[model samples]
Target: MSKIDEYIAKRSKQSADFAREYKEESQKLQVAVEVRNLREELGMSQRKFAELVGKPQSTIARIESGKMNVSINVLNEIAVATNQKLTVRFEPVTA
Candidate 1:
């Protein structure tokens, strides 16, 4: 294969990998929506929630926007801040 063709092929593979990773991450961010919902249900603003969680409000914003990576620890912190508990379930992806 020509150099340009090889580069294109490699770039396409990388893009595919990135897209798949992003999809998985975006799926995980569904939890962020839950966070927002629960917070709203409890009548808390973003800033207040951030203060309670000891995180920057921007961090909460980014998580709500699904534009940031949040770990289980951060989620737990958010839970505690909201006076809620965090739960995780691992189920195999059905084919």
Candidate 2:
């Protein structure tokens, strides 16, 4: 692994709290990337995407920046607005 990845893995093994927070932050980052990608694919600016999704531009900005804990209801609204399907599933964790 790379140096940063190695460090994170070592620290995660050493501290349960760090591991939990890391997982949470990783999930948030995944969501942020997906949302940003979707907006780009739709050729919409943040303001335009927010208008389409019935949210404020600031909300979109926060979500894209991984600073917002987005709700499923809002995600569903975004999906409907973008004419895309949103799917959620549970996966087994691997070490």
Candidate 3:
């Protein structure tokens, strides 16, 4: 693994709270990346995307920056506005 990955893994093993917070932050980052990618794919600026999604520009900014704990309902709204489908599934956790 890369040095950063190794460090994160070691830290995660050493602290349950760290591991849990890491997972949460990682999930938020994943959502942020997805939202940003979709906006870019549609060739829309954040302001335009926000208008399309019927949310404020600041809300889109927060979502794309991983600074917000987005709700599934908001995600669904974004999917609908962007002409995309939203799917959620459960998978087994791995160490």
Cα deviation of 14, candidate 2, in Å = 0.9
Instruction: Itemize residue pairs with steric clashes in candidate 3.
Output: none
Cα TM-score per model: 0.71, 0.95, 0.94
What is the C-alpha lDDT profile of model 2 across 1-95, one tens digit per residue?
A: 78999999999999999999999999889999999999999999999999999999999999999998888999999999999999999999876
TM-score of 2: 0.95
| lDDT for 33 (candidate 2) | 98
The sequence of per-residue lDDT tens digits that candidate 1 reaches over residues 1-95 is: 88965765566577988657755675768967887887688788999888888999999899888787788999888777667878889878431
Q: Estimate candidate 3's alpha-carbon lDDT, on a 0 to 1 scale.
A: 0.96
Task: Determine which window of 10 residues in candidate 2 has minimal summed lDDT.
Answer: 66-75
Model 3: CA > 4 A from native: none
- What Cα-based lDDT does every candidate model obtain? 0.78, 0.95, 0.96
